[model samples]
Target: MTSYYDQRGVGLIEVMVAILLLSIAVLGFSALQMRAINATDESLVRTKSLTLVRNLSEIMRAYPNAYVTGSATSFTTASPTATGAVSTVQAVMSSSATSTVTVDAKTIDITTSANGCLSTGTKQETVDSIVKTVPAQHCNMSQLAARDTLMAKKIAKDEDISMTVVTCPGTTTQAIQTQMCVIAAWNDTKAILSDSDANACATSNGVYKTDSHCLISEAY
Candidate 1:
């Protein structure tokens, strides 16, 4: 049998090895915790983006007719009074993450007011008929544009969004303008879509409408 002192020294070496192994295990656990936190943050950002899209879509659908026939007189872009128009959808995304959101508007503008009359014809002379096209961009184009800018700001706390109103041929009779879909997308290089391609998803009202197709990748 070796001396007791020799056995004591072996026990100390064993203890040292155990301590080193325990430290490595603790570091592994800490790393996993950090990864979990990062994943949670990314998930939250994605959820906010989806929610922002749905919320804006709901607003559009809620007032579908307004988008088409929004009168300059009735429209107020300076300070919107619509419920959930200001704070709810945008504040969450802007405040919660480093993400950026943008919205773009497309319009079909018709030029040259035309003329038409009721089938009866007995009621009156040729009446000027102007049917504003869908995706309207009216005299209030500036206001509408400004509103979109504000909306972008409210949504992303940044004015990185864009809106474009394009002119198109109207119905057989009168000139009309229309405001189409509003697209919300993150400005990240990794983001799948952009505003220019938003209209590709919509039905063609006429040759007059702008190209609005979204080139969504298969990876999405």
Candidate 2:
């Protein structure tokens, strides 16, 4: 048997060990919480981007014959050159000149008054489809397309998301058809299939890039 006096420091040692373990647990929890928050943020952005891309597809479909099937329009990441950087790009079409928007000395792609895309405003996406003419006159295809572009752009800007709208090489096995692609880009540095490269968005031909941080939707 040992006296309490002889064991005086034993309790202190145990207490210190407990404290060390507790501190480690706290640090781990903190890290996990931060990771969860980041994941949530990434998910939110991606969802919004997908919605916007779909919206664009519907807009194009609504205005039949407005879009020239051969041409392409991209409202893509602000920094297409930088891989995995958190930025938006909006590629405008000209069919002749490239229209771009610059900020902080960085250039982003935006669509111009191209044959397929009408450059204009955001959201109010459904407004154009309302046929708000006073006498219900025939709607101009070009006007509708332009309004659709603007509405899409505004919505994208509001969500802080990037966009890319392009015409893809549709399959022609049976009959001639056209395919339109809409891409929503976001920061997806830490994700699956991303282990390969950071160019998973749309290419010039509207094909998906492997491991890139973007989503694509199609219209025909």
Candidate 3:
């Protein structure tokens, strides 16, 4: 009888060990599945961010003058009065030496007065035709750029995305050229695993806060 009881106790110990091992395997699989889900979510967010950046780049290319020469303006779609739904589109036009002016229907010649002062002399000729002032087409490039930027944000369906257009000076062999840059930034839904991961996803500002992604593109 004593030998039989000892054998029964040994059998119970073996069964307990098997159950422990099985529990460990189940837990390992659950952890792996959670990681896979997180990875998929991160990938989707990255795709959306890239698409937003590319769309804004195309807008800048469409209206080069407004993006490069107009005053810097910022528009936000969150505002009640906002016409577009972009999170924010900031653009500025650069200054240039060109001007549009209107003159009478007369021929003017550049002449110097007695005191060497520059003066305009109108030539007295036969008047045959009446000159009508043609209004210049106000290049509302700034407005258009802002509108398109907002439209892109709306299309992406992400309100956290923001775009900025700025003129950056570039040096050439002949003269300085103005370059436009379209920068887009958005908050990433993925959680950062480590300091290295955050660094790898840093933006142009060198900020690795583990919360956002950024992209930039330039055009002449």
Candidate 4:
């Protein structure tokens, strides 16, 4: 017959081996959980960025006239600084996003001022300009340069994204203008490809590049 003490000691080495294997398994599972958490965080950031972009588009639509005529004024300033233009608003919108995610129409210079109206009539030499006096833009001009800046912040330090304002292929003056698309993507990092680039055509890393990946169209 085997002694109880002898059997107990014999199982000790096996128990030690089992404990070591369990520890290793737990460590491996923890690593995978960390990776999953990181991925979820990244997804949340991207979603927030896209939602911000959409909010901007809605704001632009609210002021259709100012955007089209290039008569938009700076957001904070009361006076109209320049002839109605897209470049002015675009620059401000992009720069502002780095600091504040939510931007009002005034921030982009989309607001109009009384000074923009013309002075008429020799007797009084002044006229209260009608709301219709200054023709507004036909279609609202939505700016998305801010998206590129936000994208850069999420990616690698060396990575930079490009934002190209692509106008619909036609005269923008029409009542129902074709939806203009805003193309933004990481230019330096192959991890993210531009919409038109051939690299976007490939399926890799179990993630395929769709319209939501690179290009953001402002058209509703």
Instruction: Provide TM-scores for the models.
Output: 0.39, 0.57, 0.51, 0.43
lDDT of each: 0.34, 0.50, 0.43, 0.39
RMSD of each: 16.2, 11.5, 16.6, 10.6
After superposition, which runs of candidate 3 have C-alpha atoms over 4 Å from their true positions? 68-89, 92-139, 155-159, 162-220
Whole-model lDDT, model 1: 0.34
* Per-residue lDDT of candidate 4, residues 116-162 (tens digit): 12223222222365333323311122323322323333332223433
**lDDT (tens digit, per residue) of candidate 1 on 10-108:** 877999999999999999999999999977865665456555545454443343222221232222222234442322222212222122221223221
> For candidate 2, lDDT tens digit of each residue in 40-80?
98788887877787777776666544422212333222222
Ranking under TM-score, best-scoring first?
Answer: 2, 3, 4, 1
Kindly provide the TM-score of model 4 when superposed on the true structure, using C-alpha atoms. 0.43
Q: Which model scores highest in lDDT?
A: 2
CA shift of 93, model 2, Å: 6.7
Please, what are the lDDT tens digits per residue for candidate 3 over residues 1-220? 9888768778778889999999999999999999999888767766776777677666656754432222223222233133322212332212111111111111111121221112244333333675443222211334444445545645554455544544332423211223545545556422121245543334334334544565546544
